[model samples]
Target: MEHSHTADWWKKSTVYQVYPKSFKDTTGSGEGDIRGLIEKLDYLQGLGIDIIWLQPVYVSPQNDNGYDVADYCEINPEYGTMADFDELAAEVRRRNMHLMLDIVVNHSSTEHRWFQEAKQSRNNPYRDYYIWKDPAPGGGVPNNWQSKFGGPAWQYDEATGQYFLTLFDKTQADLNWENPAVREEVVKLMTFWAEKGVSGFRLDVINLISKDQNFPDDDGSARPGDGRKFYTDGPRVHEYMKELNRRIFKPYNLVTVGEMSSTSLENCILYSNPEQNELSMTFNFHHLKVDYPNGQKWELMPYDFEQLKSLLSRWQTGMQEGCGWNALFFNNHDQPRALSRFTDDSEYRVESAKLLATTLHGLQGTPYVFQGEEIGLPNPKWNGIEEMRDVESHNIYRILQEQGKSPEEAFNIIRERSRDNSRTPMLWDSTPNAGFTSGTPWIKVDERYPEINVERQLHDPDSVYHHYKKLIGLRKKHQILIDGTFVRLDEAHPQVFAYSRVKGQEAVVVVSNFSKEQTVFQFADAFAEEWLEAGPAELLAGNTKQVPPLWKEMALSPFASYMWLIRRK
Candidate 1:
């Protein structure tokens, strides 16, 4: 196969995220692995995905699933051996698809030999690999810094009478990237993977890799005594990323993306600038955080269409030439189903799902399809908190309970916003455990699998799967959708979200109705003379009519959307 390095491949390509543990299980062990993924290569290719970003499958104790790595060079026995991974990589190459793996260098499992050796004594050679410090005079934590999952970020160890930093759970200790030896080890690990034919890496919590050495305590306001600033986008983040890129990523032609939590637009531009060899792109959470509560806990904060449109438009236009690419997505392993979160699930789930798909894929970025997203899967409804399996969910549930929140309130919050919402077993068929596993699954399958499995949708031409196929096809066939300049239309229109993609002579207009009520949008006069009836422009959903006098007003039903190709005479 000929290798293409024109930098245009990513611009025109589609990426799919595969959560290994939930994708498929071939061993009847109830856990998905690399071998299972190899078995589904044809399915992925058929879906038109150009890249597969697999979550962590490294050797670990399974504390934070696979995020806590025990050994960077070895594959977990439960997933498969190195031979199975090589086979998977070969299959990806055979299909001309890129294979990307998650890089969890920000932290390592406490069980990692390095961490174990560091914990043994302060004088150990590996002691500098992890962040360790002496306790303050009061013998309390190093500071009032709080873990993202909750509680103090520092955990005390009796052996050395010191504290170790863990931004997530105690079992996952943050690495001290300030040390040159640690940076060298990480670069070596990345090279080891790249040499095995891996094309890229999806960095995990990459922004948190650098920290404010001062370790200042929170002013008792932002986090209620928890210091988050010290841990977010610290002083040397870009420097560290540049070093990693120059040492390992650049030489291999690897496309790298960083999960930059709490990243600002300015910071994102710096991290993703094509000139800066830091990262190929960074996943921005600006739009995703709209519904989040003001403080820390998960609360019901409704979304406004105007605000969403503005946020997306700013990001789209701001990333014109020098800015790095965007990772466009609506749902992922940590997010709830897009159909449930962004649309009205009670009545217009299908239409809304289609609209969401069009809106994401039509943008100027690389679109990522999460497992089961193409079929418009709805969020699972857990009967009780005990049924949830995600660590974040369990931690939030405990925190709510301690705060004297009622069972109803706590359950409602989690049901609306749990990471487990996207972690449910993939609905492959109506069989036991959604055909994801022959035996019981590690996590419970969504109960609606009987009505929403892949088997049924694959047969229905009007299913969400087919709509995704059409949208992806449109993106590939039209240069306007891939590299066009985005222009927002009708900014203040409450019921309508309109945008036009223009690339010289080629232009495509997209209009979406976010509300359940019908909406009528009048096209601007500039498009009147050039507006030729381009067939019933692929209606994502609802009714449309071409009125006379060059006026095209569409009556979009609840959660409806449409795409029209405009041509000049």
Candidate 2:
């Protein structure tokens, strides 16, 4: 493990994620554009972020909102021409900030040239580009696998009389990575972007590229309509990543991160460990899925605090022991807003938001702040299903209604779990459309934008945005936040989540009240002993950003957090 003085830039830097479609829309086309992002680089730099992760803006049919790449080498016209992207790259580098793009390689849009040719005839040279199989004995899909969007995972092509694999939308046919030609193509695309001066790539569903050759049927015990067990972290995923990293990424000094969904910890270690030579880090979805009972995304339940603690602690200790690094994040384009999902956004929005930021940033990993998370954005109580634009949300709503659920129940479900909640236009100001676009937005902007937005919070002395800035500043000034060992304290504590980062004789203690109720500050080792009496100590940060009182016999208010630094000789 590299220490702070010698660690790579990414090890000590923070990343800010931008869901391009909702970041800004400069064209008045009701959609975000690359130029709009270029216009906002200053705002991100002001927040002290080192890298920006832009979602896919490649040419596409928008079936899966840019995940279905129709052309790998070109930018979508809605975003702008390739020249616009080149300009953005130049500007980002001039400011000493790196840029990362999402690479959706597991699948391609049906309209892609290769998929089009593959579907033309069975003997076509491109036929091997994607997975294809003949119909079953009874003229049904090849397997019982279900697409993530809805319906069967296989889409029957009338012209070819074969079913093509589409784990996502029917428009996106899964690529056959076993084909040397397909692997070469993916590698060539990676090289193409790297040559263009892109510093990093976020591989989407990369762990699912390989598959079980037998195409066996699932036992139906997975998530509602999931066939992921057969392909997730499949046989040759690590091998392919090793080859990719050795040839293209490592040479270019590019940081590579894979979006590992439904993956195992063992596989994740190999994926990100430097000794394994696969990826720099991975975005694991396990902790984020704790709220989904039985692995079903549509079915919502109150997030389990203990389950969250268990998963986070396991990954934290596991990855460290395995010589792998993690990418810490709470919200992204695919999940509901963080403050609303994990905290009481109504009464404790600001404090809980800061507490969440403090807890995650205090850990030993590269922290990622999703766009607008610093402002304490909450999930919208979207009026009805019709107001939702996310394909997954609409699909689950339809499925729930077909499963005999009442309209009210289905709408409530969508309200609680829709990805649309995070895709709303960035709340910039109090104006209409939240100052995102003068034209209509692709989706409804959150109604609370007037009260909670960048303009309102950027200047507020005690806003979530400034609090996040303080956390970022602290990480920049302290070495322990990056290189120290982590030990979870008070394993059985119910309400207070406590942990310590220790380096030599000095340590930093982070304690957060995870619930919206007053709680006694009792943990494995209170500050009264080694911290208050046996060593020199000082309060580094708190929800109030003040050392207002003594540490002993203090009642932590709802969503309160405090960090103390201790030094011993």
How far out, in Å, is residue 438 in model 1? 1.2
lDDT of every model, 2 decimals: 0.82, 0.86
**Per-residue lDDT over 1-569 for candidate 2, one digit per residue giving the tens place of the 0 to 100 score:** 11123225788778899988999999998888999999999988888888899999999999889999999999999999899999999898888888988999999999999998998899999999999999998888998888877788999899989999999888999999999999999989989988888989999999999999888778778655578899999999989999998888878888778999888888889998898989989889888888988777788799888888788888888888898889899999989987888888888888888889988988878899999898988887677888888888877888899999999999988998888988989999999899899899999888988898999887888888887887887888888887778888747678877788888878888888899888887543454566556576677778865443435455778888888888886
Candidate 1 local distance difference test against the native: 0.82
Candidate 1 wrong stretches, greater than 4 Å: 295-297, 524-552
The clash count for each model shown is 0, 0
Instruction: Kindly list the per-residue Cα lDDT of model 1 for residues 1-569, writing each as its tens digit.
Output: 23574754677778889999999999999889889899889988887888899999999988788999999999999899999999999999999899999999999999999999999999999999999988987878888787878788899999899999999888999999989999999988988889889989999989988888887778876657566677678899999989988888778888888898877777778888878878888898778866776733388877766778898888888876546678898889988887887787657778888888877877888888999899888888789888888888888877887899998898899988999889887888998888899988988888888988888988988888888877777777888887788888765798888887877766677778888897787766565444435323333322233322224565666766767676544
Model 2: per-residue Cα lDDT at residue 456: 86
Candidate with the greatest TM-score versus the true structure: 2
Candidate 2 residue pairs in clash (backbone atoms < 3 Å): none
